[model samples]
Target: MDIVWFPLHITLFICSVTAAASEAALAKPNCSSHCGVLTEIPYPFGIGAGCYLDHWFQIICDRTASPPKAFLNVIGLEVLEISVEGTLKVTSPITFSNCSNKPLGLQAPNLEGSPFVFSQKNRFSSISCGGIALMTSLYGSTIGGCLSICDNTNTRVLQPNSCSGMKCCQTTIPLHLSAFNTSFGAVLNADSQMACKFAFLVDHDWFTSNSTNISAISEMDSVPIVLEWSLLDYTNFEIYGTNNWTDDKITNCSSHCFCSKGFQGNPYLLDGCQVPSSVLGQLFLLFGGWWSHKVVRKRKHIKRKKKFLKQNGGLLLEQQLSSGAVNVDKIRLFNSKELEKATDGFNADRILGKGGQGTVYKGMLTDGRIVAVKKSKIVDRGEVGQFINEIVILSQISQGNVVKLLGCCLETEVPLLVYEFILNGTLSEYIHHQNEELPLTWEMRLRIAIQVAGALSYLHSAASSPIFHRDIKSSNILLDEKYTAKVADFGTSRSMSIDRTHVTTKVQRTFGYLDPD
Candidate 1:
């Protein structure tokens, strides 16, 4: 009886092994699993026409190449590695400076409207003795960059794995980056006669670990960049609907799909993820469910924040600040939560003043510093540009007579500007509605007038660019604690080059404050 039962048990075990092998297929049935040297062309990313999940995932196998190379069909990027963990490593081209025989201008691959985005794990790097590289978004906004300058000794030696703005420089790329362009400033020293400058986004880990000799980077034409891929809609893939294999439990599916606890393989294929055979493995899955759920929630929250940041021009602001284009040292990019908490959800009681541009609210920051927050009323595309322009202008102005632009918050629907909270009211309040506590004497009035004139002189002549304050008025001027006048509200200000005499524009001024000239 024992011998008979042993044969029956062996038969059952053989059947189970066969079933597992059939279920754990890496690709669709009858489809090519490997292309040339790439042995791991899993499902959703296949070689043949009907094999791939979509056009974006189609891999074109170039058999004519020396070793047979696989390329991502749509983007034409050379495929280096594909991981089921939602990452694809590809060889991306370098943007060479115009000084080189290589094609001029940035040649960054366009990934817009595709399922792939440049992963944050990549860094924007520049290889040159004396060059300033800039990474700009598809919308023409500067996003990331680095300035590499040679030492005074004019030596070609660069420290291994060091990119600290000398000989070689590196900076971080923003989140949700799909497409970008690279540009370089004029050569720092033409007599240096160094090799041509080039910039590219490269996988940070690979670059640091492998590229020990940083000086040799100029000889390379392309670098490995990691791209994160995701299915915009997971419903396009096959769903698991079996015991202990529900869509949400066995296959964690969101914008992207992944095998659940105790499973390992492609979640995009039917029963692609292999199930646990041992009871201990199954028990591990049960305990891991809570942690997995927590991780998913955290990831979703982070993704949402990234989306908001990109939409609110945070990347552009970051680039400007990092590139040293904005000379001010105190300009900060405040987050939405910080500004919201400071203003108590923008309570009406904290209203400082209301204007055609926006409303101002008085608040105290976490650092116990008093600040006046300016929240724009409406935020159309035009308004957003104007808001950014105002930030740029204020950031460049360092005049003592001008209201100091402490920082700005762009994460909100409308951008918010923070300034040093003026203890006293506007000049209009003092002139029209006299303050009983602090009366404006004739001597004080003369001093305020002189300060205002000096601020105007600075704006028109001393400032980096000549600025025209189209809507200057008594209400736009603020008095500090010591009665020092500050020229504020540069929302309608326009900057022009010194060569230009005047700029034509539609009239933008307060009703009674129009220039008589």
Candidate 2:
């Protein structure tokens, strides 16, 4: 009799567990979980007043529309998506310029005293021929902005899916950003009949995935932006009139809240997060193995980066900069991933030029700044010290005619150097391959020569250390949009102490331009 009873009791317990798991709640009892069109409005967000966790989570379902669209009542923005992952997607209006026929005011949403903040996944974007867009906080503080410029041509041909400061430009927003105002400066060539200029904050991923053509974007009234949501007090179960969840049931409870291991769904709702009885043990093992693998990979990646940093003379450069009077902040150490993304995985199309030392690629940084990245060929380990010294010397030299070294990336097998992007090509290109439309005039040539001589003089005598440009030719000189000369390519240059008159070194010069000395 005892054996039979034990078997029956075990069966009953299993049945009960399965029944409880199937009853996992998505929203408050007797509350609508979703509105028309949007079917996945998870808990923490509800359609009725008492259904939601708080006022901030209230969703007002407007039945006047054809499909009865849902809107976030607190912010009054149309809700596109609400995920348990603590993100809310909504449609935001675009701010048009005064010259545009559309409305001429800013769309500044006030999210103060709420749990929502603009996520970093959104980008501040602007569209104009030559205009500057600015984003400011509620307190009238400048947040960030970008400038978009284009040529004065009737047929403005913009590249499809590219926003590298042409007719369209994009920049990143600060973290924990809640509210902001968008305004535009004076447009360069404002035309009422032309496409109207506008600015807005949009989801970066969505914008990149969609057709970024001016016509397509101009047709749209609004764009989707993501907002990160978090609960200030998760332990306040009294506010919800429930005491079902304990501290052990939730994890990552600092700013954002998540279910513990083996649990799923909204952590803010009672019984909203649960695991099936049959797959409970399997999920535990799976999560454990995944977490372990992630940890191992992260550690390995960090170790590899540290090894590369030391090997590429990063440590030596730090020591030299600390010992000298040069400002260490002038030169930045960039990670390899950043440059890779900026250059679209270093695509072949981005190649600006190639030389014996390395190849130069045109890339746009996250801040909308155009830059030139130089990926060098493999170097001997013996020359690591010299490379570090050159970087130190370059950081100290500040001349208008010299190409500015913005930063370097030592994490790659071949080190990369970043410099300010020059709009025009090298002097050699202009001299060799002339353009009929924009020919190099004699006056421009004379001005370039004078600028080059001034740059060389600065390098030789004006700098803190006497430097010699072993290779100085037309190909080594770059021109800006205004035809100003910018001396470049310091790979073959050397620096000497102030006390020394001259130092002998191996001659490194281009053929047909060698000095007779």
Q: What is the TM-score of each candidate against the true structure?
A: 0.46, 0.47
Name every residue pair that clashes in candidate 1.
none
lDDT of 2 by residue, 1-517 (tens): 5445654755665664553342234566667766777766666788776777778888999989988899998789999888777898899988886544567685957787798999899999998778888998777778899988866664666565567887889999998888899977766666632556789999887887755554477767788899988876555573346565465676886666788898776676765666634645645554576568778988998888888888888778777877874557898888898999999999999999998778999999999999999987647767665556557667878999999999989877777889999999899999999889779899989999899888888888898887787778899899998889998888767777899875766768586553222
- Per-residue CA lDDT of model 1 for 1-517, tens digit only, reads 5445655655665664544443335666677766666767777888887788778999999999989999999999899888777899999888886445566654768898998999999999988877888888768888878888878787657777777788789999889888998888766778654567789899999878854667666677788899999876444423332334445434546667777887766776776777646644544553376457767987987787687556656677677678675755678878888999999999999999999879999999999999999998865654566666677788888888899899888766778999998888789898998778878889989999999888888888898878777777899999998889998998877778888876777777676553332
Q: In model 2, which regions exceed 4 Å deviation?
A: 1-24, 99-101, 153-156, 188-195, 211-214, 233-235, 238-247, 276-517
Instruction: Give one clash count per candidate, in the order shown.
Output: 0, 0
Given candidate 2, what's the lDDT at residue 117? 91
